[model samples]
Target: MTGGRLRPGTIFGIGLNYADTIREMGRETPTTPYLFPKLTSSVIGDGEAIVIDTEITSRVDWESELAVVIGETARDVPAAEALGIVRGYTVAQDVSARDLQEADGQWVRGKGLDTFCPLGPEVVPAADVPDPQQLAVRTWLNGERVQEGTTKDMVFTVAELIAYLSSFFTLRPGDVILTGTPSGCGDFRTPRMALKPGDVLVSEVEGIGRLTNPVVAKT
Candidate 1:
């Protein structure tokens, strides 16, 4: 059932979807979901190495999130029926280059680096995930438990996201939507956690499986 790996399609990502994360950063709740794109070239499957070019970015960080996979062609989907087009759920790490993200003011370059979007170990069918909003998500950096939260904290629900996104354009099968990460991302940590060579990052969602990746120095 792990056939959840994203295929030929655009993967959309959302920012500030988690309410606690917004509050933790002292930001206002978003009236609509803030969106971004993790270019398809940035995708890596489970166990793939997340290569980082230290020269280009000294602040590569982890943002574990839940990813929803599209099962059918959809357009102008309604929130009440959004989940109908979903194929399954998976895990993804929104690996970010914080310096570039904050300095550039736009997220494309900061979030679209090759291997920046670490995708699934497997996709769990939507039928199996009765309530995506109720799932628990966690992130582990190396052996340390760095983040733990539940989807219940999301400011925008998954169904709402689907409906909102499809309203703009058609969402095809295999397209993915990264819901958002929790408040424990590396950039917000006390000492500021960052990804470096030899670090293993594990992202997990309750219904979906975990994605485990190792950090490597970009040659």
Candidate 2:
């Protein structure tokens, strides 16, 4: 709720939703969307500091994702009507502790850390974005563009994702679905790129505003 609105309900995340990103990480394309939950405590607004636990981990990576905010409850909704339930869209940086993520065999511990999820400069109303599927998304670290892609590359469209998700669980108002990031993540690089104490990560979605934040070591 960075745009002067109250907070939402549960926030859902769809992992590995980008095909190129999956291939870059040397993983096979998922037959269905991979889902995860981000605790509300983990969410922080743009320009906030993303605290890194230097003692436990030395490698942290940035993932830029498009977040969908739900406006109504939906269960077993059809893809055709999925967009109708959306309230707005925002940018989210899925900051990850790679070591913890790999060691745990699941994303919860690695992704659920405090300040791991940085969301928004503001939420753009859904009415403003005619096609969420065609927007461009990019990520920059210290002013250097690292990730660039379009939602058209998404393995599953936002509407399709909503339909697929609603088939299992009920989606309520304020619930958010973080669409996955594209290729060029630090962990997928040849030498592996990790966030440093002074690094700045910026994520931007076309039409949606940009979100910038500094990386700091945990006390």
Candidate 3:
């Protein structure tokens, strides 16, 4: 289903899960998932505009990720059985306001802004995607490829993340897990390429679909 019609229950996000990402950010790998929460209100569909309130923060960045869709209610599951609770996969953009993210010393406000999370074209069933770790994830800014990496580079695999999350709370159907994004976010770029008005951001996942959103200033 398209993001416009897909309303998830809870939106969970992972950070520093990719090796390249860790290096780019000059941080160490976490022993466990670095978790955060994104508000469901930020959900937007393909073709929607990712409005940036320039007054709030100018360093709007793009994060391409593989989104996991929960299929059933699970708690304290084992990694081996984690995949069974997945309904499917989709493309998601974990848009961030870098300024707020750093200044607050926490991520909720920076990453949970309205329209910060964009998902879909469509969801590929779990049966269709045989291996989540083998997919390629990418992001494009204004027709330029800014980020490129594979899910295989993820420090925490899909199954591991699911099991880890389920241990603390129940994962219900329609809940989404934004498996960590790979390196190459604008925040780590040499010159830093931030999203601006009139720019377009495209997030894609192999076997899933591409989600395109335009950048605009909040008027």
RMSD of each: 1.6, 1.4, 1.0
Candidate 3 Cα errors over 4 Å, as ranges: none
- lDDT string for model 1 (1-219, tens) is 235445538889899999878976788888999999889999888888999998899999899999999999999999999999999888989999999999999899999999999888888899999999998999998888888999999999999999999999799988999999888888887888789999999999987888999999988
lDDT of 2 at 15: 88
| lDDT-based ranking | 3, 1, 2
Cα TM-score per model: 0.96, 0.96, 0.98
lDDT of 3 by residue, 156-187 (tens): 99999999999999999999999989888997
Per-residue lDDT, model 2, residue 192, is 91
**TM-score for candidate 1, residues paired by index:** 0.96
Using TM-score as the measure, name the better of candidate 1 and candidate 3. 3
User: What's the lDDT for residue 108 in model 1?
Assistant: 95
List candidate 2 segments past 4 Å from native.
2-6
lDDT digits (tens) for residues 1-219 of candidate 2: 645332657878888989899889888888999988887788888888999888878778999989999999879999999999999998988888889989989988888889888888888999999999998889999999999988999999999999998999999988989999999899889899999899999999999989999999888
